[model samples]
Target: MDTLNSKKVTRRSFLKGAALLASIAVVPAAITSKDASAAAKATQAAMQYQDHPKGKLECSNCIQYIPGKTAKAKGTCKVVEGAISPQGYCLAYAPKA
Candidate 1:
């Protein structure tokens, strides 16, 4: 019946595919870091964040808080995949640390 010839997908091929998938999963983190860094730099240069003096967001009081050495440390956001402005306010802002 030529079973081997009729069928494809060997162990090596499957492993290769699995490896490819693993690598693909890690790509987003790398990309996010790059994009986040760029965004942070731009934000710092342009000063694109407002202080909620009488509002909210104080590291331990932010939804996207990651806790850094400083209160303004860049952290991940629920809406944004990368780091978000500690003082940055968005529509998806939530009160959570």
Candidate 2:
């Protein structure tokens, strides 16, 4: 009886561990898929910054723009990577509504 009980416990533990690993593997794939989708959208939008802006359009007024932590400094954009300037203009620009 004792031997049978121990074997059942071992199998249950193994199954639990396998289930945990499977869940961990699935979470990253979901996150990666979301990131890939965002990248695709950015590409479709033709996201790019211009040194000389086309008009009054700038990162500061774009919906994707994220203001810098401090004043008078470059900020960031949701679609564009790297440090972005508030005065910078990009093809992905969408007016803040």
Candidate 3:
């Protein structure tokens, strides 16, 4: 009777499997949950609020107005330099003052 008794798993293989499992477990979190979406929508609504039919909130009035702190990864507006509010309705509405 011959039996295979010494088939051990390598460290590399174990590490790879562990990493794969870890990534799989975190994929859902990384894929933007419902709460995250709601927050994003709220922010968007906050910044989209214009005074008139052809006006804008700009960044000076935004609650989240972080001058020199906003970026492409923050929101959709390219005029402001920081993360302005979506419903941020301001009087000035300057470009980036």
Best by TM-score: 2
Rank order (by TM-score, best first)? 2, 3, 1
Candidate 3: tens digits of C-alpha lDDT, residues 2-77 = 3455667899999999999999999889776855654543433344544233444444444434434444233433
Off by over 4 Å in 1: 1-54, 57-60
C-alpha lDDT score of every prediction, in listed order: 0.59, 0.78, 0.49
What are the clash counts of all predictions, listed in order? 1, 0, 9
Q: Write the residue-wise lDDT of candidate 1 on 1-97 in tens digits.
A: 7997899898999999999999999999999998876665333224333434225644346565565567777665544444555666544445762
Lowest summed lDDT over 10 consecutive residues: which window, candidate 1?
Answer: 41-50
**Residue lDDT tens for model 2, 2-88:** 886776547889999999999999999999999886665353125667644568887888899899987558887788876788888
- Candidate 3 has its poorest 10 consecutive residues by lDDT at 72-81
TM-score of 2: 0.60
- The order by descending lDDT is 2, 1, 3
Full-model lDDT, candidate 3? 0.49
